[model samples]
Target: MTSMKRVLKLCLGSARGAMVQGGALTVLVLLAGVGLLALSGWFITAAAAAGLAGAGLAFEVFRPSAGVRALALGRTGARYGERLLTHDATLKALVAVRLRLLRGLMSQPLRRLERARAGAALNRLIADVDALDGVTLRLFLPAVAGALTLLVSVIGLAVLVSGTVALWIGAVYGIGALGIGLRFGPQALPVARRAERALQAVRARTNDAFAARADLTVYNALDRQIAHAGHAATELAKARAHRDGIERAAQFWVTATVQLAVAGALGLGFMAVTNGALSAPLAMTGVLAALALSEALMPLARGISEFGRIADSARRVMGDIPETVPELHPRHDAKPMVVPPLDLRSVAIRPLIDTLSLTVEAGEMALLAGPSGVGKTTVLNVIAGLLPPDRGKVCIGGTPLTDHAEEDLRGRLGFVPQRTTVMDGTLMDSLRLGNATLTEAEAWHLLDIVQMAGFAKSRDGLQTRLGSRGNALSGGERRRVALARAIAGRPPVLLMDEPTEGLDEATATAVLKGIRAYLPKSAILIASHRACDRVLATRVITLR
Candidate 1:
């Protein structure tokens, strides 16, 4: 609950002023709506009674009718303004929350980040964020409006009608509204939360089925995926149906409260009229006011029932976020430096590569040849500052990686992970990602160094559009493009994992030479299985 409050505060703080104005307007809107209903009821009842009593000309209709019109217009305008302010502000707050949530997720260590970023967890993160809309827009503002409307309506009744009318109507209406909330909220909350989860499950399952369609089809297991998705959908339908039933029941209770309170007001008003203590018209006003006030408080009941869903979303989002976010990425104020030696000292990430120290200086290519699962990629990840080594320090230019921010420290190095990822964009955009200022001519030069100039020309030159993950290009082309992108910045240190994996022996040897020729002073580290990679290296470090 404390964490949920914190998350809500963060969202509300994003647009505090607008949210405040929206809330105030919410109260005004509901009050105006009640005033409109009550006034209209009084005008109709009083005019009809005066005509029956042969005194139609004695009753003034203009002022009351004018007041009704004014209240009606005011309510409409206020309602519009309230919607605009609250929704706009909430949208801005949602954007802020989304960025903060991603920043929080990104702060996790690489291993944890990978785990948390699996299809289902990431989908849940997004769903939870979307659900936060219910927090301020549904629960908070409406609750405030409902409570204020009830209080103001009670005071108005006392002044306009009679103290007795005010007392009984207020008691009945307040207790009934609160009772409806208390009755439905607790039972509906967990049910609503379960419904929300079930809905997300449907979405996640559907996405997985489509994503793994090929594998599922190959194994003749597509039906299983469909079954899982269908089961989630069924659960979602049941939960929502239950919530709908609860909401409908609440409406029944609200209507019943309105009638009971109205009946009491009618009883009190008739007695007052019989004794000549109150006019018949104002008596109708009191009864109608009770009806309007009861209806006005209905939003509170719905908001209360929705609290479960909102709290669950806030809790999940807040819980997933780490309080202490490490300053892994460099701040803009951080100073950049030239790349230094890739240094490791007795660095270890248990179960493999234990108690090892190594250094690759500037202008050297040190090949790490090792059997699979010997932590070659792990070493690259450590050097890339993605993974924190369990045992020892990894330093750059005599500065510890932890002390240095990523953009400040690793900004001086180029790292290509084993799995290639290219954003959907043109070839020029891909090349310019590493060095924003890279020119068309410079891009072609790097392409030539990696022997990809022909590949670029065969397509659209620099304008060739790459598909998702650069799937438009072949495996070898993607690798070369990744290599070209990394060296585009010409960092003094370069790390590549199985970089030459798909290329043939001759192309692989040339690509390696081209990278060295392109960055003459760069310190390069290659983790690979190919013999050609070891032959061209300045040194080879083998792992058992």
Candidate 2:
């Protein structure tokens, strides 16, 4: 019903097969351990009783000893196998989760993305996804294994001893231990979730303090910021302590129930032995069984406490994710065509542009000039289909933009904006964003067109690794690099938004010349406020 439930259910379905395998191994491990302990108790007790009665020589010890040894080995092997299987399955599930999250984000509407609070949403995407990684490993597998352990233990006791004894053991373990664990589990959900959030808050504060240390020192608030971060950490610690305290208490209650079950079995076994309904060796076996089962059941409390945290993680990770949209698959069958002319019909975007229509044909350059905040960039975005028009439509090559999938259409479009953001990677990596398979020679040629050939050649060339945000390059160089990337694919529609905003007149002129020379036949639309940009345009459109 809820986002958390939906996400958890989806993940469970995906990982169910692996979960079953791991759970089966876990159940084997627990059963073997309990069986070994019970057999050892019975054999030792029987041997002592027989020796005192002068029948030690006739008592069989070899078979029971071999059985104990076999069970011990089996338990050890199953425990190891369980760890390996569960961890591998969990890792595979996490990979699936990340892929699904990426697809979800890609398919989300741009408008919705814009509306989300950037920092909080981004934090949830990273942290919450990581938190959900433990769901399959810790909660689901353990709970299932615990259930299997209870079922097998109860059934065995019924056959070996009495139905009354089996019911007693089951009621104590199932109704007492497991019931208490489950009852207290939901209470920890809110507290544990709050603690997790508080921890995130502390981390965020610490990062902020480190990132802005210099600014804080300059403004004489460095100590204050540090103190604030310390306060956040303290709050996080308190929340964690409270959640852990609740978990500890639940564990105590479950442990007490287990002890009670063991005591009950021992007392009942004594009475049955006295009445000749049960043997002394068999009585010892039942007591040992209860003891071993306690070991298996106590962890149920921990698993129950973890349920809240996992549920919270699922909710956060999947809650904000928008509904899936139609995926844009590559159309390999579609033949490549010439770049189409860009057209806008009855385009009205609020107070910025009203009833505006324009077309930029091949080999033509259109300049859009307006004062600041006039939505020049918005117009470029609309035409690029990054944003849809409030009214009217945009067409390229006589096809409405809506008719083509975003991924399929974007391959044929080249866009360069005012601020160039280059990733921290090699020069080739940056250029490859436009065309992944572009050769080194073609990359060099594009760089030359943008006047970066000499600079790149003298340095590491295409292999040069740039600093964060491409800060290693000058403002002009970064812009040129972005321009080269945009033109690398030689797309039909080229949209430039304030290309020469932060450049000198000479640099801006060279940049415009590079564009015209590189993409001579592409339908180019440049939104700029500079008069020099208008001069290079074959036609200029002005907005008041």
Candidate 3:
């Protein structure tokens, strides 16, 4: 499919639930609008005909009063329905887009996402999605409805009065509004793109300033940072202003051209009446109908302008989502291996900066001792399927790690990084990651296993709330909670980084003891500089 089709498909897929309601409402609104316009023309025609017949035009004189009233009611009802459906669909689409973005981020490596400007992603998710409201809700349905309404109104005018004059008015209005509006599509899209970029830059700069607020305050550079933020905001405002200006200019030209076309049609209509080709009442009705028909183009003009903005914003956001990730596939269709325990064979780890090789057999507890700059964590990442090897294979039970799907590989291992990232939730919520179906007893059991039972008991047990990033808990508590979660899953392979860092000697010893208790059943690989002779691994690899 083409790129535009693909983007639209993605949007529809996300908001499929809402699209049902929106589509129904859109149909109703269009019907109502058409009815209202037709009733309006009838009112004008009836009033003109009554006056020519020498009877004072009265509301009771119109034969189709009931139809007019129904049309008016339909217009009101359809407007409400359209608003309800459009809002529902737009919100649903936004949610779907948000979920897709999150999934994309998860599939990509942290390094790649980090390399992108933080503000750009945020702007796409927030502002860009907001911009799409008009496109999905207003642009497609209204433009189509307006075109059809214009056509029918023009045809009705031609049948009632001068056909040539009606045709001329229709052509001018259609070309000036729909055609000229389309011409501005390309011009306005770039402005929307620029606006999106500028907004992202502003968000990124503000985020950076907030993240470094402490440092900025200490260094007395807060004012400088604030000034920089103002500059970014100004840039975004300027881009938005330019886009709005272009849209306004396009709208004005369309309105002016349509009005001029109506005047010309009226002139032709007057001559036709004077020459006895058409009745005075018919001529008056023709002029009034032409003006009404021409007005339908207004929505088309506005929709085209708004569509350009929506399409541009959607493109920007969709483009930012990562499209590629390294895939791992074994050379052969290897059978799944069932061995006594976890094992790594011919495992070579190559980080962005360095490379290393190692192997660990089942029932072995190994500690990877190295300086801060070494490829210690990189080695663990390879085992966890987070990173791909440069030239070697990671195997478990003689089965290449790459041979297994990512979900299967993940099921076989447990990982705890140096900086524990605690989600915003209760303590039990974090522990539930190990096993979503874990029972209350099982949760407390794992907390006991990690020597965190006392900590949980001290608080409100598993019900204790944790702040965002676990700010409510200390670094040591966060590490223990993460460790408890990793071990709770009871995977056969455990990879830990600085599990004992920042903990007191007594707490560190207790945490190490708990980890050692699981070493007999699981192959444990830890990266740390501190030596624990009591829980020492059977083998240790020291890297420079």
Candidate 4:
């Protein structure tokens, strides 16, 4: 909750003036609506009274009619401007907050980010951040505007009508509004939160069902996966329906309360008119104002219903982020070492590889060849600084691994893991992740090197959108895409775990040749047991 408050403070503090102006406009729009109704009622009642008293011609209609017209037009314009400013400001704030959250997630170690980037972590990106977007519009602004409008209308009634009438009407509204909130606010919160959880489950379950479709089919469990997904969907639907029911029930109470207040005010207005303490027009003004106040109270119903989910989402999201995020790239004054391009000294990861040492210098290709479970990928991780070795030092260009900043390591080194997956973006977007300023010509050149230029051009060229995990492309094409990405900038040190795993001998040889031609000075290391890969290795170090 404190985190949610901080996020709101950040949002409003950043755009205080615009949000304030929008809130004021919201108040004006609602106030004008109330005033318009009251004045219109008074005009009709007074004009009729003047006719009965045989002085209708002497009564002024132009000014009252013109005032009504102005209020109506002004309310419409103010409403439009209010919506535009507030929504625009909220959207801009959402962008900044999302970026902040993304940066926060990236601030974690690469291991965690790698593990969480797919299903659940993605919710933080699309669903969770979006859940809090309505905080200002649905809750804060409407709440302030609603309270102000109600107060101002009650005060107006006191001045323009009987004080006793104003007192009773205000009491009825104030009590009713409080009663409704107190009654449903707590009850609706938990239900709304459950709905949001169910929604997340639906997303995760649906992704799981599709992602493991092959395994499920082979195991004769596809029906069970489908059932799981269907159950999650059903749960989400039920939760949403429950939340809507709560909202509608609250609306019912709000309407009944408003009607009750209007009726009492109308009864009091008749009595006041009979006693001659207030004119018919003035009595009608109070009655109509009481009725118009309903609009101001309407927002409270929605605010109550959404209160739990938005606040929870905000708290959880913001709570994960610290008040200050340290610099992602801490500058290093250390110069590059004149040693091998890749070096590891006495590295150990328990039984995986004890006291292992190796180096791959510039323009050399070192293949780590071993049988399965020989800690092949784990050694690559240590070289990439992804997993710190238990007892040894890893260095890049003579600089200790810990000394290099994230940006520096990424800039100087490239590693393609055994299990590669594509991000949800275009082919160009994936390529640009490696080199942000990469152009179409360069992208095509790299694709041509990987023998994927025809595949890309066959679809939508560089702009072709790949589905989740590159489902849009074949497995071989996806592997090639990862190869192209890893070597996009032609980094000085390249690490590959089965880069040519699925490719035939002919294509693998050509791809390997392209990599060498593109980066002749680079130190390339491969973790492969394939004979085809062993053919071109300048040196092969077989792990025991």
Tell me, by lDDT, which candidate is best: 4
Q: Model 1: what TM-score?
A: 0.90
lDDT of 3 at 107: 72
**Residue-wise C-alpha lDDT for candidate 3, range 232-330, written one tens digit per residue:** 788889877887777687778777876787688778877997888976656666665566654456665566556656777766656655444234343
Cα RMSD of all models vs. native, in order, equals 2.9, 2.7, 4.1, 3.5
lDDT of 1: 0.84
lDDT of 4: 0.85
- Which pairs of residues collide in model 1? none
Candidate closer to the true structure by lDDT (higher is better), 2 or 4 = 4
Off by over 4 Å in 4: 110-117, 167-170, 204-224, 267-277, 326-340, 345-358, 385-393, 402-405, 423-429, 439-441, 453-468, 539-544
Error of 4 at 533 (Å): 2.8
Q: Rate the local accuracy (lDDT) of all candidates.
A: 0.84, 0.81, 0.71, 0.85
**Candidate 3: regions farther than 4 A off:** 1-3, 13-28, 51-63, 117-119, 155-162, 275-296, 299-309, 320-341, 350-363, 518-520
Native-structure RMSD, model 2 = 2.7
* Structural similarity to truth (TM-score) of each candidate: 0.90, 0.91, 0.85, 0.86
Clashing pairs in 3: none
Model 3: lDDT of residue 174? 74
The segments of candidate 1 whose C-alpha lies over 4 angstroms from its true place after superposition are 49-55, 300-306, 324-338, 449-463
What would the per-residue lDDT of candidate 2 be over residues 1-544, giving only the tens digit for each residue? Answer: 1765566566666677776788899899888978988899999999999999999999998999999989998999998988887777776776667667767775566667767755666666677777776676666666677778878988998898766677787888888855776578778788777878777777777778888999999999989888888887888788778777877888888878879888999999999999999999988888888888876777766766666777787877775555453445865654444467999999998867777899999989999988888888889888888777889989888778877656768888888976678889989999999999999999988887777889888899899887888989888788888988898888889999988877778768887888788888899999998988888899999877
